[model samples]
Target: MSSGPRDDDVLRWYVGVPIGTNPLILMDFATVLVLVWAFAITAVVLLQLFFGHSLTGEHIQAAARLATRLVLLAAAGFAIISFLLLRNRYTALYRLDREGLYCENMRMGWGEGGLGELSKSFHWRPFAVPPLRDPAKSVTKKVPWRLVDKVLPLEGTRTLLFKSGRGTAARVYCPDDGTFERALRFARAHIPEDARSGPEKELQQS
Candidate 1:
């Protein structure tokens, strides 16, 4: 029986994830403030323009003002539901080693585009619907390494994606943060000496 390390076995560890940051928690406040401020500023400017003209058309002015406020509110509301909350479910970490690629989904998030796939509903209504389902973007579904080749990390989110090396491909997405970090540390610890980089190389030199 082969006793040493096989060319395709990987070691993984589960590291704990830090609590969600305060800034992340406070994003709701930030969004509300920005929206309120933007609307207020626009209202002030429009008021100045309308009044300066000495045209006392209250009905027209009220309609235009209501339209502006409704538009702004809709934009801000969609931003919160679609991005702030849903996108958080899309982060993950990826580790590549000689024993094949290892992908761990351990991040927090919900909707697509953030770390998930933009949904069919979101296709026509980008701002109205959360990213729901897409076969190509489903790269974080945990699977054995023998099936993956390329892995893409979502920008600004913790989601990591995996795919067939080339040609026809399958995809996976990982959104778990704590477990993925731990697995990455473990993979780094066991990666072959020849394939190690950064501090890994330095450690071997010592």
Candidate 2:
């Protein structure tokens, strides 16, 4: 919400599920546990069938081995996936300023601190594949306000669609009604006059 023109302007809002913050991430971890539990139970059931009522130490040991292996594999898979997801979320930063909207993809550098610093670096790698470095490629965009086409209100957030030929868009969660209204006002003010009139006319008629 800090709108200052300083070197470190605070982002007004964020879009994606934050690292270690969204409950959905916990649900994903729970899924891994459930899968491991199901595999262990199935293994135990199979062992019970083979051993019948005369279940012995060897049968228990076999089931234990199967369950341990399954649990280890599931945990390893979950950890790798969660690491990539959190890394991507932690590095993304989108903001709207007086001049325009901006998005930056960054990499972590020495001497940085906190989550804010983490946003400086891009960390997503599909299956841990490193991205090819391109010196000519830009990691940030500062789109002018007039180039924005529409500001659509969503449940708990808003999406701004760009009029640029590329069809780019940015989504931001509005923590409260006041913030939402302010974002809408800024978006409306920047939209072209002809583009704004059509929506207004339709609303009045309805």
Candidate 3:
């Protein structure tokens, strides 16, 4: 095989998928905390409106202190949310040429060509999506996502990674333009008929 893709290779289609732990899990917990905070603040405000007249100055001061705490708590919730979602970035790369395809599961931390140990590789004829953990059997040259971030949206891209190969291969979902489907078909047709198949079951997202 050639050392690298050529300039006029006519990159028919390419895409990468990024993977990350679900933010929904963190979101659910954050919701609970927010609900508790809202309920507590509401209760305090109600009590103050009804009981402020009879309450001593000290009691009103205590209520004010409680409100302060709620503000701080709200700020903390925002921070937690940013931490959970912002920090999480799932990334993958899938690029195809007339000859073969190049896909990488970057969310596992393959940024740039730094996939050194984390990258997976596949070629056209006798096409294959080899696993990274099983390195001895596979000899793939890492393929970087030269334009994954530029062309595709992140969420859609992230969902793309976990299709079939966990990190190496992916299921071609309802593509709006069939880029993924074409890539999958191209891989199957061009890659070895018996190229190592991916795991039996994989993460499925509609």
Candidate 4:
């Protein structure tokens, strides 16, 4: 791991998952399913409202069937997206600085050089179904330290999860024990004392 640009002494590292087996990938797939189901249900309700149809057991069953179909479609879409990402050996660079944590999926393999630049120039129109963008071109999430309500360390996966009241704000995937230790130490220093949890808090108490 190395510090980022001259502007800030940022701790940064790259995490590459060639197979898309990371738990975060599954979490994203689940999120897609949830959103698809939500949309399907909302559409059904809106259609019923437009026709002045009251809610009934039959309508509920029909909604369930529709949701199942939508979930299947979402799963297919997820598979295609995962394939595209894994085919390129998905790589993400994580940077932790004074302000917050920044995670950017970098363009790898085929999507590099001039082609990647060309893709970056293209913009999606509002309300239009956008094509599957390069994994590197995906939106990045920046989680501020102030919103970190809990720091959860998973020894099995060598991952440190920064969580807020809402949910996981950021996930730092350490490549090794040394990296994990360094990240945990940095988290302990920045995160509030009251938010500390697990064995770290116990050790601190002692």
Question: Best by lDDT, which number?
Answer: 4
Q: What does candidate 4's lDDT look like per residue over 30-142, in tens digits? A: 88788888888878977876796687777767887999898998777766665553342344567777777887755453544322333322221101111223443554778
User: Which clashing pairs does model 4 show?
Assistant: none
Per-residue accuracy of model 1 over 19-123 as CA lDDT, tens digit each: 223233335555765676567655655776787764346745664676567656866775566455543233323344545444443433333343344332122
Which structure is stronger by lDDT: 1 or 2? 2
Q: Which residue pairs show backbone clashes in model 2?
A: 106-120, 106-121, 106-122, 107-120, 107-121
For residues 117-139, could you state the per-residue lDDT of candidate 2 as single tens digits?
45522432101112223212236
RMSD of each: 13.5, 11.5, 14.8, 8.9
Give candidate 4 misplaced runs (Cα > 4 Å): 1-10, 18-20, 31-35, 38-61, 85-89, 97-99, 111-141, 194-200
Per-prediction count of colliding residue pairs? Answer: 28, 5, 12, 0
Give TM per candidate: 0.26, 0.39, 0.26, 0.65
RMSD score of candidate 4 (Å): 8.9
Candidate 2 residues lying further than 4 Å off, grouped into runs, are 1-88, 91-98, 105-138, 157-166, 173-177, 200-206
Best by TM-score: 4
Better of 3 and 4 by TM-score: 4
True-vs-predicted CA distance for residue 173, candidate 4, Å: 1.6
Question: How far is 109's C-alpha from truth in model 4 (Å)?
Answer: 3.3
